[model samples]
Target: MPVIGVLPYFKDIHIEEEDSVALAQRVVFPRPGAFNIAVLALPHLSNFTDFSWIERMGSLHVYYTDDPAQLAGAQLIILPGSKNTIDDLLYIRGRSLDRVVVDAARAGIPVVGICGGYQMMGLTVADPYGVEGAVRTVDGLGILPVHTVLEKEKTTVVRRFRFGATDGPACAGYEIHMGRTEAVGGERPLNYVGEGFDGYRAGAGCWGTYMHGILDNRAVVEELLAAAGAPGLEIKWFDYKKFREEQYDRLADHIRSHVNMEGIYRNLRLQKR
Candidate 1:
């Protein structure tokens, strides 16, 4: 088993105005032997940019992986939200990656499924609208004994949700999914939206939620790290809105440094010529 260490919470990091720029730059760079996290890549993946927050925290090194072998050293695995859940699941199974995730979860590695990833963790998922052009029930990984049905009314709302009895921290995020999940065997629901199932936690290590923008909540990441057995880290309390604005500014700076916007624009102009 990989030895887990708890890092200090966010509150411990005292960030001065002058240090913010340096901290953001340093966070974007991966550290050697840092805790590795594998994010399962889907063809229709979105919101991958959110991972910048994790990287800035310095506790996790995130990588994209579709290969099952990559899961071996990952302390935590993230199944990000996808536009095509059925296709992604089938692609993973076809590559024998489904077994890899199940094996990892069974071995007590932390696994998080968000939105479509959440649906894949259930017993069965039914998409009736043919949004992804598939209307069939598929077997889930069964990490959580839940069932999800895609409804016509798509949920795209930002709201705050109260976490119940969880060890990490209180979390709030935006929901952007069409399917609603229900626990079949009377298990406690992971998330609650006025008595409806919004998320589920299988054990101390594995958790899934329907919220797409949960990463916007630094408290959520801190709690997740704590649950994953990271070293005890201090928690920083900040206005969530202000924190998000800071993150966005930092992200813009990161992109300016790493991405060649000028070169891309020149190339586009040349192509137009």
Candidate 2:
């Protein structure tokens, strides 16, 4: 029997009926043997909250370890977006975690990098403008033969994309990055924006993309999990508007229980600006 953790209900929603209460409790809680994911901890990291979708699915553990050996047990390794790509890469190298990441990829583990993490998967990352104040090019993990150049043009927008042959739902997300990537000769692209390279998936186990919030796309999550060799997982669709409402309610309730809403609202407002 799998063990699930049932979280308390949000203040706005009430579970008065017996069956509804049980289902809500089950959803709030999760069973054991759930997929474990390791998210690399880099300074100035954001969007940790977006991973709530994964928590809703099953037992998800977050690891902040820079130790390579600690990453070996996770079924999925996520290199999350960071505010400073060059600094994060330097930090990883300082901690000697670069070899760990490469070793994980070589061992056939499913490693996904988003934004700064995505930039780190290439052959070189150049920052010439000193926008990040690093102004130096560094060698990437070399999982993909891609090079990213930090440019004045920053791409920030929400859009929908279709990729992969599976009949799953379309992927919708926001792209927020200061770097532009180009595929080297002989490398395949993962996504395109009107025929421009947006991302790349290397072999069966490694994937990198500039898209943030892609995890919100249930189909994309399922596809990545399947590539990781997960069994018996399927994508299901619901009214997107309704789903967003429910999710906001759930998050509001959860945060309200533990912290003051003033700080949360303030931070969100600043992010929008």
Candidate 3:
């Protein structure tokens, strides 16, 4: 079941009733002066919830699509995590989205990858242990100068790191993947986490990292947009926890008015006082 199934209204005039509710619960709908952004709609995409933080300002018009043509004009491009890296990477190749991503990078459009996405952006992914399946190896998008090898031990841990510049700000995210990657060339890492760093920054607008909730960090989001050459798109971060609580109260009000609560209570053998 999805969150929109029960909600009644939506801020977007275009979205149908059901989907609007789902998005409404997750993000602030119809932000003013929204900048267009695209997220690769992979078949196995996962952990996209953190994107809500990026869209919190309502300044980004975010949409998920698998079409390569859609990548042309996006202000920012994100390659989200996947449960199966090789399979999804093959899917990108089969659909020719790999070329689209590479082209977008050449055009200076910001591209950020998380977890499985980071692996696919590398030079090659070697699955010696068959951690992802029968596929032994696959060539990556060849965008970032890195190589990844799938391992048997899955890494799932909370991480704290510095993004964009090494001396910038300390940001926290998580790592949940089944591979190890190493930089093979002059590509500089995107962040410094603990004693080590994460991801590789190919350019001002090009990078990839294993951090799952990288966008949850305010500095990272601002940097991503600014690197995309839109410095005027100011971010206004708000309390998500507070917003969620308010939404819950609104939902409760709607349910109380619309539902036959007394009837439901009686049916459940509870006192309806």
Top-lDDT structure, candidate number: 3
Which residue runs of candidate 2 sit more than 4 Å off their true CA positions?
1-34, 59-62, 165-169, 192-197, 233-243, 247-273
Compose the digit string of candidate 2's lDDT tens values, residues 146-210. Answer: 89999877888876665543232567778877988888886565555443445787854588888
Q: Ranking under TM-score, best-scoring first?
A: 3, 2, 1
Output the lDDT of residue 217, model 3.
77
Q: Is candidate 1 or candidate 3 better by lDDT?
A: 3
Candidate 1 structure quality by residue, lDDT tens digits, 1-273: 432322333433233333123322332222357677777766666555445456455445777777677656677888888777888878777878788888888887888898888888888888877767655767888887889888878898876665545333456678887887888767675555544546887765687788876766765666667676775744344465566677667655655666667776777999998
lDDT of 3 by residue, 150-264 (tens): 9899899999888867786898889988999998856588889876888888876788899977887777877787888888875678865566567767667777766667766
Off-target runs (Cα >4 Å) in candidate 3 are: 1-34, 241-273
Candidates in order have lDDT scores of: 0.69, 0.70, 0.78
Better of 2 and 3 by lDDT: 3
RMSD of each: 12.3, 10.7, 6.6
lDDT of 2: 0.70
Worst lDDT window (10 residues) for model 3? 12-21
Lowest summed lDDT over 10 consecutive residues: which window, candidate 1? 19-28
TM-score of 3: 0.77
lDDT of 1 at 235: 37
